[model samples]
Target chain A: MSSANSDTPTRILESTLALLEAPGGKLPTMSDIAKAAGVSRQAVYLHYPSRTDVLIAATRYQDQMLDMDTALAPSRTAANGRERLDAFVTAWCNHVPKIHGVARAIMALTSTDAEAKAAWDIRMTDLREGCAAAVAALARDGTLPDSMDQAKATDLLWALLSIRNWENLTQTCGWEQSRYAMTIRAMAVATLTQDTGPLTDALACPEPPA
Target chain B: MSSANSDTPTRILESTLALLEAPGGKLPTMSDIAKAAGVSRQAVYLHYPSRTDVLIAATRYQDQMLDMDTALAPSRTAANGRERLDAFVTAWCNHVPKIHGVARAIMALTSTDAEAKAAWDIRMTDLREGCAAAVAALARDGTLPDSMDQAKATDLLWALLSIRNWENLTQTCGWEQSRYAMTIRAMAVATLTQDTGPLTDALACPEPPA
Candidate 1:
């Protein structure tokens, strides 16, 4: 593809993000997005076969622009399971606030709009894989509690890192962003693994002198 | 007021719930509800001045129908903090599935409809109070960790009990209702209290031989 041709998809995705983050929380239709991108509706449809396709692509494009891979590298390359767990929590907790605008937009549409639901399910499926990888690291290191298998551990961790949980902590509870990340990291470590690391240790109540 | 006059509000609230739970997840306007209840729109308005008021009343009416007070009695009457925590988790987790339909409906409308948002906020505020009460019990019993304040602990517990989390666990992850309740209860006890009781103990990995 020529340079000019290549720029079209980029423009479309950027316009998609801008419209999604607009004040009203109204979902942008194909024609709306195409108009914002200065392209014809047919051009938008040519690149993305359907609205769900473009939405999913736009979200992925946003993540790329945000350097999600770089943010995830520490967790991906951690030396041990506990470190991996901590890194993952920190990365995800921090990332939630950044993607929150678009995430919330898509999430709000999931109930009534099938296309939006499709985009959301795709994103969540990817996130679940990350959770699975973290839990697998714990299992490989023998730090995961024996009673909790890898699947259940992943499920628990994924639930813990939900965007809604972050929204509740930071928005509804009025917690600082750093504190939300710290507290969630501590909670994840305490509940998911047998790591008596400093973070988890700090979360434990003192035993009365036995 | 005559008995017949008082029955109008009950009929309106019941019809509101029926419409909310109907297929296709379309939000019911006052006229739709009045039609369902076999009352004139003016009669519905006589009982509820706005759609928001009726939505709120309907949810509380559903709770009464479900005997929420009876479900909560065990938690309210628990002898100590630990027992209260466990009872509260069990009660709320079990209740989520029963109320999932209506909860999901209100939640979907929150981003777009101010009336729905008002209803959701009221329900969440009530839930936060339950979380606060549970955390206060832990603090009173001196089981809350030194590093975490009661407010923060309550926030964590409230986030954990979110209906979205329940939907993810039981619907997305396909966990059994019993497993979701048991796992969440154990997680709450393990992370929120210093209790080394059976549930928390079961969660810990065996320490390496010293």
Candidate 2:
């Protein structure tokens, strides 16, 4: 592809992010994105074959804007299963408020728009993969409760850290962000794993003997 | 008052419920309810001082249609705090699927409609009261975890049983309703109470050793 052809996709993704981040923004349609990018709708279409692809790309763009990898690194590189769970919960809980506006718009759109659903599905699938890895780490350490199914434990962890659950606790129930993170980390540990002797050492940011 | 005057409020409430229950139903405006009730707009205004009042009344109408009192009797009559928690979880979990259609409609409306939010607020306040009572019972019985403040414990319990959380576990995570109820009961007890002793006896429908 020509340099200009490559620039078109980059420009389209940038425009998509700009639209989503605009104050009080609604989910921008393909035409809206094309107009924002100062390109023809056909140009936007050429770069992103479908609206879902563009939205998904824009979500990734937002992640890049926020440097998601750096944010996620502590969890990704944690030394053990419990540490991984804590870091992962903390990273995700903190991430929610930063990305919440775009997240909410995408969620609202998903009920009616298939493209939005597809975009959300892709994002959640990625989160669930992280959750599964955390569970696997616990299983490897023999800290995963023998009674729990790996899949079920993953689902519990994912559901516990879900954006909706976080939103409800922080927004409606009036929990401080730190408190939400700490409590969720504690709760996730309690819900997903078993006692592997002296596991407290691995539970970073323990809440003062509570 | 004439019989017609007395019957007007009932008819208006019935119309409101019908509008919400209809497939793809939007939150009916006062005018829509008035039309559905075959009454004048003035009549609707006379019966309900505001749209919020009408919607709130309609929600209560749904509760009555479901005979919420009988549904709640088990929780109210539970012999102890832990049992109260279990019964409450069971009642609310089962109630969600039964009322999900209208519950979802009202939730969708809450974003754009103040009246829908007011209605939701009233319903949640009622739920919060139940949570508080359960906590109070635990505190009274000397089982409330000393580490947990009563208010915070109530918030945790209420958040655990939130409709969104239930929806995620059942719909997205694909848990059976019974499993969701059982797990939530276990998690709630483990999260809220102090004792590791003799508590399983109070956990109604305990999943056998799993």
Candidate 3:
């Protein structure tokens, strides 16, 4: 393939992100995106058959630019289930702010737009797999509570770490990013671990002095 | 005031709910809603100065139709903090499905419409107050964990019972309504209570026979 052809897709994806992240939260049309990318409508169509395909690809491209895999390395390589849980929470919570713009754009489209819903479902399913892996790690170490099986544990963890939950805490409740990460990690440990020691330790927030 | 004049607001609110809860999830314009109510566009504006006012009032009308105050009585009159927690969770979960249509409509508008965002915020703020009351009950009973203050516990519980979480569990994960309520109640008890006994009991999902 010509270098120009390869570069065209990159330009399109970058332009998609730029438009999505712009103020007002309005969804851009395909022609608008093509215009922004300095590409013809036909060229945009040649690269992506539909707007949905390009929008999903743009999110993936944003992830690549942000080095999402490297950010998740610690969780992937954790020594044990407990460490994995902590690392995963830290990594995911920290990552939420970075992806907030694109994530918000996609989420805004989800209710009325089928393709947007599909794109979102794909990403969430992937996130669920990550939750499952963390639960599996805990089960492997026998630290998972006997009350719930791995699947149930995974569901609880996944629901607990939802992007909406993060948005509610940080945006609605005005929690600082670091505090959200800490509190959520602590909540996860308290909720899923078999050991009471971590539960108490995790739940302990320092009191403000009079 | 004449009976006709007094009845216009009720008619307008009911028509707004009907349109919002209709199939297609398309936002209804003032004219569409006025047409549905057999009133002139001027009548709608007379009752509610703007679309936002009418939309907010429509949600409030829905709550009245569903007897929301009666539904919340159990939580309001709970014998203790733990009872309040269980009752509140039960009441809210049961109510979600009933209002899902209108809730989804308003949520869809929130990203692009500032007025819609304000309406959603008003309802969520009310919901958060319920969460705060439940947390306050726990603190009163000295059953709240020492690790977090009442505000923090309220934030956690409010996030836990988000409508989006309900959608994810039921619509996405295919959890039964009964199971979602039961499990979420258990999770609330497990996460915020000082007692570990309820934690184990709440987390226990009956194992299927091999």
Tell me, by lDDT, which candidate is best. 3
Instruction: Arrange candidates by lDDT, descending.
Output: 3, 1, 2
lDDT string for model 1 (A28-116, tens) is 88999899888999999989998767777888888888998899999999998989988988999999988887898788778767888
Candidate order by decreasing DockQ: 3, 1, 2
Residue-wise lDDT of candidate 1 within B1-210, one digit each (tens)? Answer: 122344778978877777777756576877898888888999988978877778778888888889877898999999999899989989999999888778887787788778888889988998889989999999999998667778878888998999989989888998888788877888887777765445435454322221
The numbered model that scores best in TM-score is 3
**How many clashing residue pairs, candidate 3?**
0
What 10-residue stretch in candidate 3 chain B is worst by lDDT? Answer: B201-210
Which lDDT tens digits does candidate 2 get at residues B1-210?
A: 112453778888877777776776555777898998888989988977887678777777778879877988998888999888778877887887777656766776675567787778877888889889888888888777665777778888888888888878887888788878877887788777765543333233323233
- Give Cα-based local distance difference scores for all models: 0.81, 0.76, 0.84
**Tell me, what's the RMSD of every candidate?**
6.3, 6.3, 4.8
- Model 3: lDDT of residue B104: 82
- Candidate 2, TM-score vs. the true structure? 0.75
Output the better candidate (1/2) by DockQ: 1
Best by DockQ: 3
Candidate 3, RMSD to the unseen true structure: 4.8
Predictions' DockQ, in order: 0.38, 0.25, 0.51
Error of 1 at B71 (Å): 2.3
Q: Chain A TM-score per candidate?
A: 0.79, 0.73, 0.84
